[model samples]
Each structure stands twice: as structure tokens, then as C-alpha cells.
Target: MKLPNPARRSISPFGQRGLKSFASIPGPTSLPIVGTLHKYMPIIGEYKFDRLHHNGLKKYKKYGPVIREEIVPGVNLVWLFDPNDIEVMFRCEGKYPQRRSHLALEKFRLDRPNVYNTGGLLPTNGPEWFKIRKIFQKGLSGPLAVKRFLKGTDEIILEWLERVEIIRGKQNLDYLPELSRLFLELTGHATLDLLLKSFSRDELNRHSTSSKLIKSALDTNSCILKLDNGPQLWKKFDTPLYRKLKKSQKYMENVAIDLLSLKMSLFSERSNNTQTLLEQYLSCPDLDFKDIIGMVCDFLLAGIDTATYTTGFLIYHLGKSPSIQMSLYEEAKRLLPNKDSPVTEEVLSEAFYSKAVLKELFRLRPISVGIGRVLNEDAVFSDYEVPKDTVVVSQNQVSCRLDKYVPCPNEFKPERWLKSHPLYQKNHPYLLLPFGHGPRSCIAKHLAEQNILVLLLKLIRNYKIEWNGPVLDSKSLLINMPDGPILATFHAR
Candidate 1:
């Protein structure tokens, strides 16, 4: 939607000219050998790329809306703080938008071509990406797919609520770990149809195979992020982290093979009418056990981390503001009046305030520093021409927090998302994209929203939420995760 007196300025495209022909964009001056790398040595020296967003925010404050910086020699990045530039980059992204591939992940999977034989969404584009994505769209997108998941996810949430009840007496709960385990259980049950029992403390205490497997998978994921955000030393030659990553990948693959075997047996015993994602993929002629495992691994990792952290941050925000908490409770009560009422699609649709809270949370505390796309062709953004194959990054956290799109940019105001609010009319809808738009928007968007909403419904219904902790901040590696555990309390409502 367009705003009156739009902040977007007209762009005059340069026809096939060199990027250097244009005026130099404002950014930190680069050193001859290292480019601008020396400036970031403090964070890089510690291998703490998670603090990248903080650094980016600092630069945005210093350099204004549009800045171009060379990350290292031979690698230049144009960081777009304006939402209109983000829109421009997205429109020019072509049919097969090339998301910058995760280096560590690509290497880990390609190293085991036997296991990860085919390229998945992250590494593939064009017809191959479309083909792989279509398979997921049929099973993971649309209302039917979302409907199939809702009941299962809600069941998991209710079970988790019981876990919360059991631990209610604790003075403070470490929200992220517990939330992580809950989403892990939900994703395992929903995708693999295997009850990995991630939320089961007893099973974990017993040191079961599933627990070990889950730990290995998580460790492997952590390694991928660390390596991706750290350095390219592992790319040229093997390192300790690379070795650990390989071992973790092997262990996870072995666990998946075992789980798939059991799943195949269970599929035989059960009726075809009820099938999981793995079973659906198994029906494909070209795909094998390994391919199915690879897909499952993607879903398992992607689903859990995103939902866990998003929900954790939303709750953290709610807990921080008692007024917001009370208003949310009122909305929850108004929507699902009865304590025993089941959370259904119809009920969730009417929970507008709850959805507003989530939207506002994303706008104020976006998880990623920016979303990146490799340009398919030469393009001009804010009248500055950049060449083809250049990596253009939308500084999302910066854009979302700009006063041009948001009123009192730093404040937490869920009302701004409400249609009745005057500020809502002034905003550009693209400014607050938690999920990047276009053909490559998150496939699990609906599933994650449904799950988060259901959990929020139950949470508000059950507990009077409280948060009296140090300021909750976020860190960004491959994705955004809370910098630390949020201290929270749950007084039974």
C-alpha cells in the first residue's frame, strides 16, 4: 500500500554502466588489503557473528538509509535501509530468485552426496528448485496442509501446557530451551510421525537414543551456524569445527535412517488415509530414503528454531508489558470465552489483537539483520547503479524501525498494526516483513503462525505472564535467536 507523501524517491536507472561510475555511497572506508574487515575484528576475533545486527544498527545510525560497504576484498555489499529499495531488489529478483546459499550447510550436505544427493531449496534454483518446492507446496502449503497440521500441533501444545503446569512453582523459567524442546517435539511428531519425545525429561534423563540423536542434530546445526558466520578456513582446509560438523552430520544421518526404517514399517501397519510428510515423499518415484531424510532434516531444523524463537520473543514482549498482557488476556477471553474451549481456525482468525502483537513484535525486533539476494541483472537502487551478480541486502531491522514507516519507531505499540489505528494508514506494508515476500517467502509461514497462535491462546488462558529480567536482546547468526534466556514467571490464571 502506498502512503501519502511517500518516502520513496524516484530512481533514475543507469543503462549497463559500471557501479564505480555512480557517486560513492556513504560507508566505512576500506583498508587496501582487508577491505573493511579490520573494523569488525572485535566481533570476528571472538567468532561472534551473532552480534552482526548490533553492528549493522550502529552503521545505519551513522551512515543513514543507504550505504555500500565492502565486506572483504572482492566482496562488496549494498545494504538497503529503505523499504522501497528492498521492494526494488525483490521485483528485480526474477522468477528464480537466488537467495545467498548457506556456505557451511551447502558444504556439509555436498560432502555426503550419497546422503544429500539432490540439492534442496537453499542450493537449488530454476526448474530444480521449483520442482522440489512444488513437492513441499502440495504437502506443506495451502489450507488443507495447514488444516492437517493444526490438530497435531495443538495436541502437542496442550501436552506442553501440562509440562508448564508441572513446573509452575519454579521462580523463573528459562524460556528458550523449554520452548525449543516443545517445538522439537511438535516438529518431530508432525514431520517424521516419530515421537522423539523431546519434551520428556524422563526420556532425556534415561539417556535414550532419541535424546542423543536430537542432541547430535542440534549440535550439528549449531556448528553449521558457527562455521557459516565465522570464517572460510574450513572451506580451504579441514578444521576442528569442520570435523565436529561432519561427525554430527553422520550421527544425524544415521539417526534419520533408523527413524525412516521405523517410519516405513509404521506406514505399512497404518492406513494410507493418514500419512505424514515423510510418507507422502516416499511415494515419489525419483526420491529415495536419503532424499526423504534430507527433507525431514530441513523441516525438523527449520520448523523448530524459527517457531521456538519467534514465540519466545512474542511472549517476552507480552510479559514485559503488563498492560499489553492484560489486553491480550481480554482478547483471548473474548475470542475463546470458555476455559475448556478447543482452539480452532475460526477462533484464531478472530484473535486479531494476538496477531497484531506478533506483527508488532516482528516490526520492532526483527530476527535477521537483513535478507540477501544475488542480483540476476544489473540494477539501480536509489539512483545508484549496481551490477549483476552483486549481493543486495535489505536491512530489515533498520527499515522496520525507521520513523518513515513506523510511528515512534522505538516504542512497542501493537495498536499500530490494528486497522483502526491512524498510524496503520501511514505505514508501508512491506516495511515489516518478518517473512521475506515474493515466490521464496517462508513455506512454513502458515504452520508457524497457527502453532504460535494456538500456544499463545493456551498460554494467556492458563498463566498470568510476567518478565522481570535484564533487557531482552537478540543475536543473529544464520538466523536470530534470543541472546540469553528470558526470565519468565507463570502464575496460573
Candidate 2:
């Protein structure tokens, strides 16, 4: 599995002599107008959009590491399965990495000129994205910024745990919905300085703001997967799926505006001693109100699913492995000896085993099928000279699980991440990128990890988690998520 040294590869400004042409990259035979899109169609199709991670593995085995597919007629996608090639892709990703995801979402935002300045961070590219990113980075980029929310986030987790106890008296529960609410509440606190009260017993009504926001976010994401993966008919005209996306986005937009207005009105009354993420943005001279709204909308939309799915999978793995769960429980107990102890920066730093558990979970089941970048410059990958503007996807989920990159890839061995362990992996750093790499990486990375770690510590200490259902798998809906009901049993200690 040793790859040829990238340094030895022939280098050129654009195209290189004796190197494989981009057209020569092995892939499934694409048809006339349909391209390889038909291959993802119903029964005859060999692939399912929802099961893209599985499809990536299958493609890698069939076509070898580097794969080419014209997903739509003219859109050529190069899939990189080799960690070395993935590293090359990122290295060439340039200052403003153009990730061509959520085209339909971008259109949706641009269509509404009055409401949006740009398509927000997820879809926007170049200087506009960098401008907003720099502003938000000041508020959310590092551990110090995320640490301010430890007490508040812990309070939210405690509330959700109480709700879980009431809802799951003695039965296995589909906990994803609860997890979604918990993350949404956390996102609200971090991004908008609002307590969404998503877990409030009195706000059980389905039409509540929190409930509507959650539903819209989920619905919009579903529509995004369908529209982005399928035909470009939505681009030509207002298709049915496009309309659904608009509706969901419109709802979210209204909610963001209302919340922003409320927060701004209360801004003057707040103490100058502490600043929430929202207040920091409002106080920044460079950002306009519209810019703040765009950021809040993006954060709310993106935050919930990633954290929810990652936590769900982590819990499942812990439940499935009793030894690992016990080990993590022991670590959690040591970190927070009292049941009601708050998760501080010191507690987080000391929870080394808990950190390893998260790292291992990410390797096994990444929240996204792959990390994608629309190549900013022509780059050589796997000896093929791929041109600039081609969408090169880093199939990390498939590669991370491969025996070539990781030892005992199928086993849940957190020790692989521990430096002292015999099974410790010195795998390529690019092999596992759950938060992605470089500047375009997830802005909320620190905050999300803190939230997950705090919740994990609390859950492991409080309950002996168990799962007796069928083995869990993931489905891609913009982000990879648990494919079935998370029917995990929580046995109170």
C-alpha cells in the first residue's frame, strides 16, 4: 500500500509530460446527457445517494484510488482515495478554496437579493466568504472563545438529560430527535445568545419556534441532497423540489431575522463584562446587520446535524463496546467526580481517553461521506494531471477505514490514537479529517467539539449505555447520519 513519493512526480505549470491525462482516470462509463447520474438512479442504478460512503468504497475497489465521473453532463468529479493524493489536493486548495456544494442553496439566496448579502459561508466562495469568515473567526475560531460557553452548554445538556429520562422511562428510545434539540439549543446559545428552550416541557407544541426551526432545517437539508445530487432542472426553472427548498429556507430566514432583531434590541441592556458570539459580531465595526444574519443562519443550519450524528454514532460505539464504554466511564468519573460538576477548560484538557474515543469515532463514521473542493489550481494526483476548476472529492471516509492507512481498520480501538499504545497509528494526517483542513474548514469546530465532549462526559457518568438493535449504519443527507432509529437503552447508574 506504499504510494509513490509525490516529490518524485513530474511537475509543470499546468500539464506534465508522460503523466496520465485527466480523461484517462478510470471510472464508470458515463452516458450522453445523463452522464453517470443514471448509475445513481433506482433499481438499475448501482449506487444510492444516501449511501455515498458505501458507494465510495465500492468505487475505490472497482476503479482503484483515483476515480473520475461526469456526474452531470459537463461536471467532471475526480474522487481521490489515496491519502497522499488527498494531501496534495488540500495543499493546492489555495487561499479561497471553492467547494461547489449547495448550488441550489446558493441560487436560493442570490434569488432573494433583499434578504441576503451572499449565500452565507456554506455555499459562498472567494473574498466575500473570507471577509465574513474573518469576522466570525474572531468570535468562534479557537478554544478560548468556545470555553466561555462551557457553563451554559453544560446547563443545556443537563436539561436535555432530564428530558431523556422522562421520555425514556425504561424503554429503548430513538434518541436522534432529542440530540437534534440539544444541539439546536446549543447552537442558539453559541451563535445568537438565545435560549431556544428546545427542551422546555411547556414548549412541546409542534408549531413552536424551536420545533418549526428544527423541521425547516431538516427539510431544507433533505431537499439540498436531492436537488444537488440530481438533475440541473432546478437551475433551469422552479422545480417542485426547488420550491420545497425555498419554503424551508424562507422560514429559516424569517426566524433568523426575528431573532436578530430581538437580540439587537436587548444588546444595550447586556453587561459589558461578557459577550456572546452575537454581541461580538454586532460590536465589530466591519460587519453589517445583514452579515450577522447570514452568519447566524449558516451556523444554525450547519451545526445541528453534524453534532447530532457524531454524538449518536459515538454513543452507539460506546454501547456496542462494553470495555471501551467502561474505560471512558472511568475517565469521565475521574474528570468530574461529582455528578453535577461543571465541565471546565481544565477538565477538558485532562480527559485524554475521552478525546481518543472521539477521534476513533470520527475515523469509523465521519459525519460527511467526503470532503470536496473545486480545485483552485491544476494539480497532479495519483499521477494524473487534473486541471483546475474540476471538483476533486477527498474520499476520507473510505480511505480512513482502509487497512492501508489504518491498522485493524474495522476494530474500534481508541488506543490507536493514544501515543503510548502499542497499536498507535502513525497514519498520514490527511487520512482522518472529520473537521476538514485549512481555512475553509468548519468555523464552529472548537465549539462543536466542546459541546460533544461535555455531553459525552455527562452521559457516560450518568448511564450505562447499551444497544441491542440491528447494527447501525449511516446515510448521507448533506451530512452522513445514522441510517436507522438509534434505539439505544440508557441504564441509569
Predicted model with the maximum TM-score: 2
lDDT of 1 by residue, 382-490 (tens): 6577777887888888777667666688888888888887667556656777877787877777777778888888799878988767787777745677877867888
The CA lDDT at 479 in model 2 is: 88
Give the TM-score comparing model 2 with the true structure, all chains together: 0.97
The window of 10 residues in a row where model 1 has the poorest summed lDDT is 3-12
Question: lDDT of all the models against the reference?
Answer: 0.73, 0.86
lDDT of 1 at 122: 61
- Angstrom error of the Cα, residue 304, model 2: value is 0.8
| Residues 416-484 of candidate 2: C-alpha lDDT, one tens digit per residue | 889999888577878889988999888999889999999999999889988856788988898888988
Q: Which pairs clash in model 1?
A: none
